[model samples]
Target: MKIKLEKILNLDDGEYRFHFETAARDIGLGLTDYEGHEVFDRPVVTDVVLNKTSHIYYVKLYAASDARFLCDRCLEDARHTITGEFQVAYTDLKSNREVYDSESEVRLIEIHKANEITLDKDVCDTLMLEIPTKVLCKEDCKGLCVQCGANLNEALCEHAVMQMNANN
Candidate 1:
């Protein structure tokens, strides 16, 4: 979303809150999981807290969405609430001093000429990063039987029983 900085720029140093709700696709989040299953079709809710301290602006972003996907372990349909939170700092320093520090996350913006700030990419990146590498319905998921391709969490397959007996 593009946040207008007109009012914010004119106001004195203070904290401001902004809320936004939009479709996941609008922010370029129309994506699929690792298994090619569609996810996060629901609306994305974002809350921003912008702290204007002098020429520096600190923005805290919180976003959330409901998603449905097949469990990576058991391949069963499951639901998850995907959420992400991050902070970014923007400075309007007029000095020509260069910052060569690679560890600094501060961004420079033209406070006099810029009209608005677009956060679509930031929101997309935050949510994508928050997604679990291994999506699971539960922590201790039994997964599927290798031999019979059966859901081990539901019941033991014949091959699993035979394997267990052999091991014993």
Candidate 2:
């Protein structure tokens, strides 16, 4: 979502509030290609504070999302919740034209006469950070049987034990 900051940028001390909802699938997070695999179904509330002297824009966002992931253990569909609080500093491109370091965390956006700003990419990034590297339905999931590919969560297969004993 883009917000016009004409008034906020002009003010010496300004507070701007934005509320909107954006689709997780539409954004280019590259989380999943399957439709409805991951959905961000939460309201995004952003508070922007501008410091005209320093030409800095401070933004804070509170966002949440729900995603469907295949559990690595059981291979069953699991639902995961993603929530994040993000704070970022943005400088006006016209006046504060400084090169950013390769490892700099701060994101810079070029501001022209157009006072529009996009929060989509920032929101998506925050959500992506919340995703866990490994997903499991339960902490102690038994996983699938290596021999027959049977879901161990439901029941253990005797063939798997024989296979393990033979290998050992």
Candidate 3:
């Protein structure tokens, strides 16, 4: 998505707000793209606000989606709530160079003398940061029995511990 600066670019100090939504297919996002990923029918919703105080312009982006993920242990369907919030600073300076420092906990994106700004890249980047390293269906997932490959959470297999013990 892109935001035109015809109204805000000329003003020395002002606040502007805009909102947009995108489908998973539109962004080329799929469940297989993530680890143990699952996806429900939900669109990504975003809210953005831009504020200018004197020479400094501040931007905030909020994005959220209802995603489904497979449980890391039992492989059950897990509801994943993914959300991202980003804060950035913009300056209306004439420059062709782009600067980024990944050391900061909160990343900063630079925008130079541009009449408009596209948010697709920034939104996707923020969303990537929200992905969890591990997804679990519950706090304690028993997973599957080693022998029968049955989900222990659903029903305990008769050959669960006994078979392994007898073999030892």
Best candidate according to lDDT: 1
Candidate 1 regions exceeding 4 Å error are 96-104, 111-114, 163-168
Q: Write down the worst ten-residue block by lDDT for model 2.
A: 42-51
Model 2 alpha-carbon miss at residue 149, Å: 1.4
Q: Total backbone clashes of model 2?
A: 0
**TM-score against native, each model:** 0.78, 0.68, 0.72
User: Is candidate 2 or 3 superior in lDDT?
Assistant: 3
lDDT by residue (tens digit), candidate 2, 32-64: 624445434433333433334456666777767
Global lDDT of model 1: 0.82
What is the lDDT for 108 in model 1?
73
Which is better, 1 or 2, measured by lDDT?
1
lDDT string for model 3 (1-168, tens) is: 777766566776888888988876566555463454437347878899989765445779998888887888888788887999987766553231133223222222244445576677777778778889899999998897767789998887888667658889
Candidate 3 wrongly placed segments (more than 4 Å): 31-41, 95-115, 161-168
Question: What is the Å distance of residue 36 in model 3 from its true position?
Answer: 10
The full ranking of all candidates by TM-score, starting with the best, is 1, 3, 2
